[model samples]
Target: MRFVPRPALAAIAALLLLASGCDLLSAEAEVYDSPLSADDRRAPGPSYLQMPVRQQGGAVLHTPSGTRVVRGAYDWWTRDGDLVTAAAGGLLLYGADGQDGRVKDRGLNPDQTGSTGEAISALHYSDRFRIDVFSPDLADRRTIVVPASAFDTDQASGSGAELQLHGDPYTLDGVTWVEWGVNSEDDTLTDHGLFRIEGDQIDGVLRNEPIVRLYPAYDGSALMLLRQDNGEDEDCGGCVVEQDLVELDPETGEVAAEYGMPPGYDRDWRVDAVDKVGDTVAVRFRVYDGEGRDATAQWQLWTYDGEWAEREELAGVRVWFQDGGRLVERPTDPAGSPSTSAGAYPATLTWVPGETGDLSDGEADGEVDGEVLFEPSGATCRLGRGEEFCPQLSTTGSLLPRE
Candidate 1:
């Protein structure tokens, strides 16, 4: 081998050691001051919590100026500012203001359940049937067992056998009630009746009628929307003849209040949904064309506050209520741009408790004015210079790109 220059070899070896030393120092720095926290470090609190209760159709809870808290997925009931909800596993007690939330899950097997000011009631199915009543905190109070044959099963003219229980149980005063229907096998409600349960006793059929739907009033009354069978129309083959909305007294089983369709609408118009707050009732309906087909584009929303009725025709829009019986409307077309036309997806009206700086007078109505809150989808957004804006955050908590 030819002799190599000592100085050149030494220089090359020095360069290699320098490069390896730099890499070691860089790695040491990274390990010593990493951005990640230790595993046992305390975690930060959440910025906000998602509400647990899902609104049923247009039904919403009017909270009393605070964050609302609830538990489980269940049917909800409200009376005099108190909230009650039940599930197959348990029952929850809370306040309208989201205070004093309590849950009890022991000894509850509710197939159908309801709550009143006094107690919570549930119907459990075993070899037979049993009704269990519990305190608001779910303390066991009483249980009643009844025979399955006690319910009426009158079949429709051409339909097969009748199904036992058609709907969830409801409560009034201290009694629990459930609806029994026939023709359930065909998924049609032909005939129906009500049965009452009080303490350890079961009462016979209290009332029987062709009720299409039933809703519980805030004052322990039953609102029954009935369809009258006048046979099929000869001229219009599949048209409804008449429909009635009647309020029945829970004790006497008599009509307490009755509502008729507005002046122009006939029986062909059908109710789509019903929502109530305090003494006010909101009814949403759809009109039918002359050919007996549904006119989906034509929607009418009506509100009755025990004094007079107000009606509004809405197309491709949704409406809901605020805390103080206020009605909010929003367009539902996705083609329309957000923050300029209809609000963003899942837009809803929310009541802001405090003052919004944009208002000329610094007063709060517990209502949303877009400047401070959004509506219809309930997503919180900001309004500025005649435009609505929603906060968009990036995965790393930075503001997303915008025009």
Candidate 2:
């Protein structure tokens, strides 16, 4: 099983697929669509914040007793109280649901997996050139296998060719597609593409485009893409790259609409996260300097009106994921200082991104403010209901919603 480890916190550096030669997927490719029924995509049960325990390798499920699941695997997510893990063994689901323990386990290789907050997708190699899709409840599965020649690993310049699944599989008009890419062995450059299994047709759609990041619109109405110019930039010395925010039409594989970035921010900035407000799209990015270094440690949040007209940038605020109609925030007032209290580790402050209104006039003050959710006195972190977990500061585990 071939496994590619990702960096901590952010920046999901995908696997490298070979590139010496390029062509559309041959007719020999096979796609078996087992569409997920409405009942198969059932809403998840009550979720709690689960965090990984540093050095321990497993995660602490913030239940009443702080249940621990998925031992020896840090890459995991929760669906209906079950744990889906990408471990050396394979793609596994550990749960106490109807089944006794492990409910579903598939793939002969160490799968490169991601999720759409509802379903899981894995790009499997070795046994076969295929992408495996798992339903939210692990009840239904779909497989799409392509000819080995389609990858043409013999042509790859470095580290051989390997398929990289971007984000997760998404559905449009009853068809499911997964955004994929090919990156250099060093992961410095990437050629974005798309792959989907619809009916009897399996295709590598939008092959080798300059788009870098593909994410579902915050509102789940469209796909948002950050596209770059294919032309080389000989002048800036990699200082800046022109990019655009556009909504993609999944059915036709084209840009349906373009969203405007704030003046002077259309280039040299890397997108960190994106979400939707009432009528605007909230994007978080880190601006780079001439040397391609992040200019600041804190991520900037900006909002673009839905009409592709107005834009506003929020100051001095860093936002995490949006949970239950509220944007979670982590403040960075005294830059470089994680904790003001002596002998205390940095705490995760949970707060809202203010009210969704005219942000330009600074009426969105609550957007920048937050309250401390928890504080770590030592290695152990204590939360309400007598729940506690010790997280290593080195890895600094993420906050995930789970049951």
Q: Model 1: per-residue lDDT, tens digit, 7-87?
A: 665467557758776321111100011111111111011111223222322223334444454444444443334445554
Cα-based lDDT for every prediction: 0.43, 0.44
Model 2 whole-model lDDT (C-alpha atoms):
0.44
Q: How does candidate 2 fare on TM-score?
A: 0.60
lDDT string for model 2 (275-318, tens) is 44333455666554443222333346665653322233443334
Query: Candidate 2 — worst ten consecutive residues by lDDT sum?
Result: 24-33
Q: After superposition, which runs of candidate 2 have C-alpha atoms over 4 Å from their true positions?
A: 1-53, 63-83, 88-101, 106-111, 125-128, 148-174, 179-192, 230-240, 266-268, 276-279, 287-295, 306-315, 318-327, 331-347, 351-371, 376-403
lDDT, model 2, position 276 = 43
| TM-score of each predicted structure versus truth | 0.52, 0.60
TM-score of decoy 1: 0.52
Give the 10-residue window scoring lowest on summed lDDT in candidate 1.
Answer: 394-403
